[model samples]
Target: MSVTASQVHGAVQTLTQSSDTLFLLLGAIMVFLMHAGFAFLEVGTVRHKNQVNALVKILADFGISALAYFFIGYWVAYGANFFADAQTLSQGNGYELVKFFFLLTFAAAIPAIVSGGIAERARFYPVLIATFFTVGLVYPVFEGMIWNGNFGLQAWFESQFGYGFHDFAGSVVVHGVGGWIALVAVLFLGMRKGRIRAGKHTNFAPSNIPFLALGAWILCVGWFGFNVMSAQTLNGISGLVAMNSLMAMVGGIVAALIAGKNDPGFIHNGPLAGLVAVCAGSDLMHPIGALITGAIAGALFVYLFTYLQNRTKIDDVLGVWPLHGVCGAWGGVAAGIFGQTALGGLGGVSITVQLLGTITGIAVALIGALIVYGIIDKMSGLRLSEEDEFNGADLAIHKISSTSED
Candidate 1:
């Protein structure tokens, strides 16, 4: 007995959907693990006294960000709501749920990025409040505008430039938005106390290079899922995305090693710089294009990190702005350049569209963050008192250390 063609098609569709669901589930899990990388990266970079606070913040922020994204952010961005019965929610083989899980991890990254910049001196509750507002309201608005095309901005871009802004993954949406907001948070929160005075800078050498390297390695591994799994469907997956990400990662490592003159912190962060820069165009650029984009991003991170620390005295602990903000924005713009067919790419991009869209994204992110952070600042304040700050966040906020008491 031969099966009918319709029956065979139905079976294939179901199987395809199942594969997509599993693919997205894996992506969600991988991105979720990047939060651990975020925590450990901060744990290593900050003073030993503040180490435990770093761990606590990443975990706690994940929880709060989930609530915000589930209740409001997802709805605002994609008109997706988990309010239905389980059976109804289970439509599409529960793929929507898994997709939500995936996007939540991205939304959660905003606070994880901020956690670093505000590391030692932030007041815990106020930052949490800011996290809720940011993830709930600010992030979703721009996310909708870009990814979901909620505001007709994509159409406008296409009309004017012959192509819509194209961030295949989320260099601008996730990393750029997070980094820009982090910059505002760091600026508003002020520099860590005693870091600089009387035209002199004090160094807070990383407490654990191993932990930092571990964090970088974890993020590097997870980023494959972050970039490749962004396809969201098995049929959409591309080997090019994987190869481009790999090439960019190597480029970032080599550039950072050379530019940083063998600084361990810079060396570890180099791959992150590359990954961030390639996120927007990974599927479009040639391997060589990815390498160039990543090399440029790695060098940019090293230079800007030093400039922010010394020349400007910004005190962004993990240099989230350079790694995520600057490089992510560069990724947004680079996609237009490197993604073009003329550049040995898969084509279908416009630098004009990318530049405008990137500018719009970063602008909204910065403004929204400033407003939220400013309000939190004026209401209960954004920073710990000098006494609490000098005492270290682990003791002042949580009354605990990484190691046991005597």
Candidate 2:
């Protein structure tokens, strides 16, 4: 049982490799469960009549995103080296696999956002098709250009400004992408029944507040994985990332509670606001900075949700724009302000670059989504029939009722 020096060295390497792989896999699983949070959140936001429709949409999106990521999205988002030299296309599977899981979570998230936009009124098949084009084709192109190194926008930014853009998780890539897609889908689907009549509002409350609360809580839990796991490499910083995420969530909750003013929606969406806010710079900010960033996100979520609903008449079924889009932007910008290199010594980019990156990301995502949605709208007609919408997507599209006996 005498171990040679080389063998001992090999054993330690293998053990370390195994530990890293285990951590990565665990993070992936936790990220996947965020889909459950999305499903419940969408279901709770809409009327019960659309429950099965919402569930089926979430399941289909996840499945489609998985396949799409495996085939193309993975390579597109993180397969930079593969395309760098076409002759060496086969040399990047290790990196590609890691990127696939990371981007798959993002792809899943975009469709989840769309669910809220077209809730109760979309044709299931068409929505599924939109999800494929979006996650498989559109999102990866921009994301790849930013994070994948060789082909990413970061290189260009670095070359021009002497510093590259940084997004710890995917404030712009995941949440911003999802939010813009939701915006376009909402435009195509039009308003819900009785939403606007002669410039007046209608009464449309959440079907299940308890369900919404549960879904929000689950999302808060999964968000730790969503932000920290984005680091890709686990180390001491992982704990710090998790701490930032938790504190930001707390800040979001406190902000929401302070602004609640007898509004249940604010109370429900506060923690999510926090989570989304911290996503952009979870690894960069101090715990106190996270709190401030998250609190601002929560307050903004309340205000934005109200503005979109009342002024714009954009009936976001579950407030995706506020939760993901607005807070995501906040997170991205907060990175510039609170990104102290002393703590972790990461980002060297200036606040101006961060703002530019955030704005550019949002604009690109919105325009891309609008174009895609317009094309889809022209070809397939995005909305359900008026009759179908009235009856609910579940009954009209699936030929089943939520109240049906087993």
Candidate 3:
């Protein structure tokens, strides 16, 4: 059979497209597993009384976010915009599937942030409600605007600054958004029982340090996909992102150890700080730059975590604010600094653009989260009664313990 020139070109395009789609699917799967890692990490950090509650809330939040993202969030964030240069959605079955999976992973991540804030005593139903609004409405709108090249900050950045804000992955989009929401939730929920008395902080050590360690490891493993997959290019940029992420993780661990004086909390939280820190500019940074960024972030995590715990009466059960919020902001700014022209920019990008992106992302996340959490607190009541809290959320709400007994 004789093939026409047009026919031959069509076949080549189809093959290339198929290969890209497959790679994206695999990346999405790996990102999804990070949710499990988060659950284990959060459960490990809290007391045994809250173990079942933490695990259950993680599961419920993932489920709720998945649905919300699919039904509303995805469209708002990634749907084809009426006005944009790349005005049309990419054509292919794989494009639709990959887009859905990518956003779904992000949706699952936002609520996971809240898990740490309301840990020991929040009612399951109220937590779920908060998760729905965050994943369904708040997260999607910002993410959609930033990533989708439509009506929000990303578009504004491009028009005003002459270059777009770059977040290779979601250091700001996912972690920053989650962290702000967690902070707001913590503020509204108030401190855990015995956490604050007569304006003094109390000790609330982890019930199982081993669980925390394991969870942190899981997150480290999942982070490869989170960072590398965002490159959207399976070959060149993706490899760079993966390498940068690894270096950052190692650097973060080392920094934490040095700063913490061999403390377990420092070691466990270090990798996470590194991951969050490097995420903003993984695609644009070299291995050495990543190392510096990660190390700084790890040190920052140790300091912020300690400060919040000791100086303030805020009870962030798993230290989500430091791990995600503080580290995330630092990472975004570091991206601006270390992501220099000599590094790995497709072309030279100015530091100003990176800084603007970082600040804009932080402001949007903080304000949006505060508003949502405030409304929810007023309507559903963010915290449980003192009696219910003392009894444990698992027993108070589910009537079952981690052991599945009466």
As a whole number from 0 to 100, the lDDT of residue 29 in candidate 3 is 82
lDDT, candidate 1, 1-406, per-residue tens: 9999999999998998888999999999999999999988999999888999999999999999999999999999998888889899987789999999999999999999989888889999999999999999999999999889998999898888788889988999999999999999999988888888777887689999999998899899999989999999888999999999999999999999999999999999999999999999999999999999999999999999998887786989999999999999999999999998888998899998899989998998999998999988998998899998888999999998788978
Q: Which ten residues in a row have the lowest lDDT in candidate 1?
A: 195-204
Pairs clashing within candidate 2: 145-152, 145-153
Candidate 1 Cα deviation (angstroms), residue 11 = 1.8
Candidate models: Cα lDDT each = 0.93, 0.78, 0.80
lDDT of 3: 0.80
Question: Which lDDT tens digits does candidate 3 get at residues 212-253?
Answer: 888888889988988887755455446788889999999899
lDDT of 1 at 212: 92
Model 2 misplaced stretches (Cα beyond 4 Å): 80-99, 150-152, 341-347
Error of 1 at 113 (Å): 0.9
How well is each residue in 300-352 modelled by candidate 2, as lDDT tens digits? 98888877777776878788877888788878788888886664435575677
* Top-down lDDT ranking: 1, 3, 2
Report the candidate with higher TM-score, 1 versus 2.
1
Best by TM-score: 1
